[model samples]
Target: AFVAALIAGEKAAFHEWEAAPYFEGCLPVEVMAERGPETLRHGPLKPFGLTDPHAPERKPYAVVQLRQDNKLGTLFNMVGFQTKLKHGEQLRVFRTIPGLQHAEFARLGGVHRNTFLNSPKLLDASLRLAAMPRLRFSGQITGCEGYVESAAIGLLAGRFAAAERLGEPIALPPATTAHGALLNHITGGHVDAIEAGPRSFQPMNVNFGLFPPLAEGIRRAGAARTLAKKQALSARALGDLEIWIGRHPAAAAE
Candidate 1:
């Protein structure tokens, strides 16, 4: 019912006169629903951690998470519920969720355009402009997606610029770390298409795919292989990041 309503509401949603293309990292829920019935189940609605207390044995088809929005915990924000649905349609469609039958909304969702730079082409490894080294770039504008990704890039850029000012060497984070993977992506990770029209580089969130593959002997093949690979990658990243921090005590202190 939720999936069906989302698809229906997507068709009815009011788009701006010149609606911008949606970012791949932050797609609208309705757009995900239109792809397939099970897309949402694997995406925002995936019940990865939470379980119903009353029915412990039963698995949920989907889940709607509400994040606390206020200090008092009286207001809650719907996680991953970005949309462009009309106000009436939002109310109609969202109410279909099991626990939200009488839910009062603090605000309706809306869409906005996100502008990003072609960072791979324009910036160097330290996030300095190729043409103008004095200028530095960071955040979503550098094409690294998500709040954490943006902050990580910003931190790197600040450290790099400060090192230059103090005549100190700039040491980049190891590629295995989440910060390094995202920085590498923003700097020069994307492959350019043969036919040159617009650049093919897109904003991206940090994920395991960005990390270097595990050594063949270290990796195992089985149903648990995927989980095992993630654990290995995480451990490697943590170790590498600690080494990086140790090498750059000033940056770590900051």
Candidate 2:
């Protein structure tokens, strides 16, 4: 009942779509709700195959799911809650979820115009053009999503090219590091769709899910669970990254 009221009260504003093309595939949740209140219930919030143990006799009116954002499982994204809601509004609205009453968000969801390649199908481990090794790709064009992520790819590409020119072999960065995790996604970390039509790969920013999973015994939630997990992942990434940098004398010097 509270959830329904929150959604009902929420209002979103947008510039006229006539001014710019809005891809039908990524319509905001509130926009879909405008079609009819039940539209969302039939679509993203349909309650089927799920029964709450605490209230087995009661059927839920709606449901929401979260997707793991990184390999470490430290972050998750709301399954179908993309919006134009102001940041403060988003926190208030989303925090109303049963299990997320006190949830901490690493990044709030938003929509944007993004350009990226289906890199998993096209690029090699070194970000080199598979069909034409004479050329290399970097940054957002290569499918990395954020400023930090794009800059990291550019740095890696420059290093790879310099190593080749000097007749020295440079090892790929350890997948545990932020740079390696982002690069891995560009090259082959993403699985390809079997349908063989348009690719399902989407542009993504660096997050914990991209890195290799943490060792066992670090997966439970207690007080400060989210913060502790992120700290552990960051520490591991830095350690692995330093070791990788040490392997290349030229890279280390620079």
For residues 1-254, what per-residue lDDT tens digits would candidate 1 score against the true structure? 88889877744445476466778767888988889998887888888776779988888888877889899999998888888777898999999999899999989887667788888889999999999999999888999878988999999999999999999999999888999999988898777655765457888999999998877544567857888888889998997798787965776666
| Candidate 1 TM-score, C-alpha based | 0.85
**TM-score per candidate, in order?**
0.85, 0.54
- 176 Cα displacement, candidate 1 (Å): 2.6
Candidate 2 lDDT tens digits, 1-254: 43464456455565675244334446567667777778777777789878989989899888887889899998988887767667777788778778899999888767666566778878889888888888899998998776888899999999999999999997898888999988888898666556775446667788898978878556568867878888999998887787787855666555
The candidate that achieves the highest lDDT relative to the unseen native structure: 1
Q: What is candidate 1's local distance difference test score?
A: 0.85
The 10-residue segment of model 1 with minimum total lDDT is 10-19
Clashes of each: 0, 4
Model 2 clashing residue pairs (backbone): 70-208, 70-209, 71-209, 71-210
